[model samples]
Target: MKPEPVILPCGDSALSVELGAVIDETLNGRVLALDALVTAESPPGVIETIPTYRSLFVVYDPVVADYATLAAWFLDRANRALTPPKPGRNWQFPVCYGAEHGIDLPFIASRTGLSEAEVVRRHAAGLYRVYMMGFLPGFTYLGGLDAAISVPRRDDPRLTSPTGTISIGGIQTGIQCLASPTGWHLIGRTPARTYDPNRDPVFFLEPGDTVRFIAVSPDEFTALERRAAAGERVAEAGNP
Candidate 1:
């Protein structure tokens, strides 16, 4: 039998429904399922729902809904069998690997005991799931990394990582939406603007989306970056 979720209050206005302690897809599925249920029901005073790897953080108006009442409400539904939400969009992003674009490619290859080409090949071949978005705007945390290339985070994190950085840390891989400090081992970069405030949809990727990386040359990366900067949607949407 599945374990019951632990409902813990976050101050007086928000609560966290922890489904599991690990980063398993089943647990994440439940989180998303609960998010869908709560959103569909539109519970009174519920302000927002944020689904993470294995928990759902629900923010509500404390005046309209007390913590005890809301906790009981989430506990009942979280323990019940839930229908998983439909899969989100599939996206194919063009990436430029090795050399300056992916400065840590050699280090990652050495650590993983794989050739540089093999590392890039394995990374590009695997289909990744967008588990959640956090840390920064449109910074997507992805699941489903190729185990052969998986490695621990960098011992020394860089002060700044460029936007469009594709990296792997621990058992996961992710796409960096903006230039920021990161501990993940950089393997490549994609020109697609996952987050663009000026664009119609500010965020391109969302939780539950599947992503594929396509290797591109430096010239192609430059061309794509230009197009992306000009407000063009550079990433191609794939069929579900």
Candidate 2:
């Protein structure tokens, strides 16, 4: 358990708390704990807390709360939460491995020297890390993929990958929120919408939240799609 958040020269914020090399539940619990501390005992003019996998950005009003003051306060509490807690919630998401959902499945298969089914099997076999979130809302950088499954991203990225596109690249797996350009290989897709603006919190998954993949049949995929199109909130695709 590493203590003392590293203060850096962040462009927008006064002080930053860095908990390096966070994996599994450690990242999520630490993030939540630190956020609680800052928000509760915050100095005057403290504006917001932007938390990541192993860091939190404390943006404050330079007038009321200077950089030096808030930073020390944060360091004090952070050092104390290093004892550790229970692991994060494990979420298993269903995937329709190949064909349309996995447009570049064959590409990954060919490159990795395995059949498409084998590629899917290996991909869904292991647990992954929630390294960081960026490029788009709810988009997470997950680690822990087997080396054999690793493949380079596309040189010419697609213009739009649509929403719920589950793809992999290098050592990370990403899910595109809304429509956006991507270089990751499309291994599968989820009919379930991961983020919704109208919903109270919008995005469902956060940094430090862990997820697993569950394979599904084409018939199940169609059933899930119909439910989603009907305006039902598609979490885990079909109703639990």
**Highest lDDT model number:** 1
**Per-residue lDDT of 1-240 in model 2, one digit per residue for the tens?**
465467675654567787665444576568766776766667677898877667777788887876777767776777775543343455567678889778899999999999988899998887765655676876767777878888998899988786778898887787665778898888988776566676655666655556777888888877886776665545542221
Candidate 1 residue runs with Cα over 4 Å from true position: none
* Candidate 1: Cα lDDT at 195: 92
Which ten contiguous residues of candidate 1 have the minimum total lDDT?
Answer: 79-88
Clashing pairs in 2: none
Candidate 2 has its poorest 10 consecutive residues by lDDT at 231-240
lDDT of each: 0.91, 0.72
For model 2 the local lDDT of residue 123 reads: 86
Query: Which parts of model 2 are misplaced by more than 4 Å?
Result: 1-5, 12-14, 21-33, 39-44, 78-81, 229-233, 236-240
Candidate 1: residue pairs that collide? none
Quote model 1's TM-score: 0.97
> lDDT for model 1, on a 0 to 1 scale?
0.91
